[model samples]
Target: TVESRAIGPNMTACHHSYGRPDLLVYCCPPGFEKSVPFVDFELPEPPSPVKVRRPAHLLDESFIVKYNKALSIMKSLPYDDPRSFARQAELHCQFCTGAYEQLNYSDTPVNIHRTWLFFPWHRMMIYFHERILGSLIGDDSFALPFWAWDIPESMPMPDYYVDENSAFFHTERDFSHFPPRVADLDYTTDQNHPHRSNDEQIDVNLKFMYTQMVSGARKTELFMGCTYRANDGYCDTTGTVEHAPHNTLHTWLGSSLNPGREDMGKFYSAAKDPIFYAHHSNIDRLWEAWRKINNRRLDITDPDWLDSFFFFYDENLKLVKIKVRDVLDITKLGYSFEEVDHPWLNHRP
Candidate 1:
């Protein structure tokens, strides 16, 4: 099993070893300086009626109002509270940008990205985020809406996120890539790349999605990412989807002028934007959708993969340690994605 430590009072500055030394990375909040105790995670009974996460484009005005209200309330909480929005965003920084080190290997950083840990870790992160959002609104059945960028009609940035007056809005994003602008699934940070019309871009995106989700992801390791075990220095291989649309979408939404694309462009500051949850909700849904593509499509059976763990502060502000095995099934977690037609499923490149 990959032994890990709960992020407590000992977090270090986030350093992107591969990036410019002068670049400043976001750090955990002052709240993390106070040692917090964590409890072993216990599986809760499935919700009475499974919470159905819908696409961002299809959300009604009422759903948008409720979501905006919940986020506003979460942001209003004291910074010391683990359930507060600032703390939650810092949690992503702690895990992804070398803020926490391995349990016994002080020199080795524990990074959840660019490895098999990517999916489950993010899944658990958003799971608790959704619960906290729902709890703030007094609605246990509320679910996070997904930005289904793979779909042609819903290709652009969702409308609700771009509303400047809404709580979901974040300032540090590329204004040129707003709604009605079809997202390039194979987006590149190179400014010189040629542009395509909406029809052409949609066709290209659908083909790209098919390649990433189908032809490119046939094996468990290929779909999930490279294995990362206890004391491993760093595993840099990422799954196809994680490499493209996932990372691409981040850079696409992030402000081009920022040092490292603040908010969505980089790991340390990604969750600072409220739309981060919606983006990840779609990534989580893709994991579920990928498994159903073939009878042989299954999760990694390695004991190390199943037994590795991470820590998170739940909706009630109680720190909990949860294993990867515990989050393999979304249904058991009391939420599911609403069924939708995947046009990209048939658009082979």
Candidate 2:
């Protein structure tokens, strides 16, 4: 099926398969000579996420009068024009305090892939924080849902903050303590992961999920790599392995990036923090469940990582500057996310 419209809703696609984008090629372990397996295809079946809890209140003035009547048909360009909305909130204040002073100054690690401006700067910081939460309830159709971190049951306690009773939360104090072994390198390596009293000790890489193949034309390996070699720690990246991708999770940061975690590239105040739009609506639902896993074969052609770029922090908090060509066009900057009737649990990593 694979229908259309995303983030705000109406996205039909019971399933479909995909292929070719340089047919999938990766090599870093001991400098390979050859390895191209995509094997033909078959890899969709890992979507079971929907756990957003923390609304309490705000948005009810009839949701800001039905979103100022959809912002009077949505349009706010000339605030003085630097490409206005007030010079894109003045380069979103050097992209959220210059990405928290270049990712808290460790040793240069920011790589949302060498840059076309990290996907239209987080799709114009999730379309100006979903149009300032749809201009505070006036309603431009309101859509915000990511937090599925690929599911370790939807992780929740990495030191949890944003008080005043869940004040529009959005974390990433640049959290740490991962590396039990994504091939281990040392962000202090071994913080002793018994997982602070076994929430299944990191829930086996969020339940497990990975299927990739194309075969003959070249190479492929993770016919379903489920992390932990053959399954022992079980699964746990839902709250930390720093959000997603390992066992060979290479977006290559989209393609060669690491100016030392440049504050993990903006989104700083996380759209006035309502848990940063439900943790980037579950990081845009794990980038649309990792492009409908395997069968959708993680598409993404890399013309310099398809011109990446990033900058965000909008809603009175300002900081805009986005591009990946305006998020490959998240439906011409509007809204469309649903999945919330509940019971999203077939489970996989």
Candidate 3:
């Protein structure tokens, strides 16, 4: 598994690119070494008051204030600090981009995207991120707001993030794609694509969400993505949700004028934007929603997947090694999404 290979001695940074092979995107953390021994992850006793992640658009003023303050604190920390916002964003880059390679497998990059590792890997990433934010604000129950793009009324970029003074704001985002401008879930980079009215776009988005979550994803592999191993090369067969609304929203929010769509469009820079977490929070919520949709729709029961692990710096600055099985239940990790109307639940296209 990638975990065993990654923890090996002599682990060095791997050179790689995002879209174009020539356009190298270097995101490896400075002063990284394999000398720090990783402590095995242990599931915590269920949180006393499980943090409930709310929709970004529906977040109350007090909650938004707290959220902004937490992010501000995170951003103020020195870049070298593992719990700093800078390093948190770089963590995503290191994994999604080819910044690390399988220890014994020569030149074989370890990427969590486009494979079964996608959901579980990201779930763990944000779990720690949320913890860091809550810790910064001195509130253990603080939760991240999710960009509820799947719903009709909450479709556009949340207004809280649009505030220039808020910590959620990212200047690199597409100004034209700001709030009130309904998002195109099927959005592509093609400039010539026709535009739709707000009502029309919302209608289309609901249908797209329905297809990705329901009829299109019936099996565990189809919903979560294909199997990926430590020695395997890139596995491009992304799950239905990851391919459409997940990937499309990234492109939709990113600045199209920028070279590689800095901030959100590219994996290397996606988490740099505060909205990235909210967006992924929704993706993570969809994973849970998908599971409840059908009794047969379940997580992959393969040992390789259950045993696969990733390293993360917790809110306490402890370098902990977490396994895939550890994050299977959000309640165990001390968080859950707020209940909301799933308009796309029955809107089968």
Candidate 4:
């Protein structure tokens, strides 16, 4: 219902000091300094409702194989193709690294993170990403599998993404955190923390989720994040869930050998990794779950927040525009998270 203004101007490209040095090679596009009209148009409604997107850890072998095959087809596409895997990944780098400008806002930079748009924007992102993969495999019902890392048993990287021969595999992830190794939910760059037993770690993980999901994020602003209006420029705050396990996992999975933790560790390169989509799918599910907590939590209602918009190339590689409103009802998009045990909902400590 709401249309987005032009994306803001390209901001100065910078790098996080903690990231690998080699990643500096990526720069804003040559003519990206000038504003370009982001094509805006409505897409025809889907012929049917979206499919049920399931957790990566819970996927059957058939689903896993189909998922991998879709990715393989996407990866095999020519890089110059808008729907190609390389172009798909580059969309992350460009938007995140300050390549576009907000429309009608004097070219102020428009970064998706650290603001309310983070959730809806990313939802649209993976939505199109899933569509692209599905179209490539000629399976309109295909959906992306989420990484349900909150579950203790599902903490390790899903085997579907780790096989070396799989197009989903990326060598940059932390080898020490591989399967048979549970994730440290509160992990930081700090490497000196004393190791705890698997039982102890799982206990710690559950407690962290309890605190983050219930205690820490009890309201809209606290849960979804601060608002960003036109001319607000890049956001200064990040939402609660986006801050915790979301970021911690990114840093933990980053490759030690690659500069700036190619693919997973940094925003500019994260989408390059196939696991990035899975990780985000889980994050998206958390948003749905967050709303059902006590039936008190709800999405923010600010018009500016609701009006925010973003663009993505659909499965057909045709440029299409989307608004934050389009994603509020995932069912309309024809997708829903697979039902999983919500042990964290009952956790109190």
Q: What is the C-alpha RMSD of each candidate to the true structure, in Å?
A: 2.8, 22.3, 2.5, 3.7
The sequence of per-residue lDDT tens digits that candidate 3 reaches over residues 37-73 is 6688876565457899999888899999998899999
Quality of model 2 by C-alpha lDDT = 0.32
Off by over 4 Å in 3: 1-20
Global local distance difference test of model 3: 0.84
Residue 221's lDDT in candidate 1: 79
Candidate 2 regions exceeding 4 Å error are 1-76, 79-93, 96-131, 140-143, 147-149, 152-279, 283-349
TM-score for all predictions? 0.93, 0.24, 0.94, 0.88
- Screening candidate 1 with a backbone cut-off below 3 angstroms (N, C-alpha, C), the clashing residue pairs are none
Minimal lDDT window, size 10, model 2: 5-14
The candidate, 1 or 4, that scores higher on lDDT is 1
Candidate 4 Cα misplacement greater than 4 A, ranges: 1-49, 294-297
1-349: candidate 4 lDDT, tens digit per residue: 7654433333333222212334444534334344445556453378865678887777898888898888888888886677888878877776665555556553465777777777887888898898889888888889898899898878888987778988888887878778877877888766797587777888888888988888988778777877777775565687788888888888778886765555688887788889999989999999888888847447676667766776677876665767776678777778888789877767779
Q: Lowest-scoring 10 consecutive residues by lDDT in candidate 1?
A: 5-14
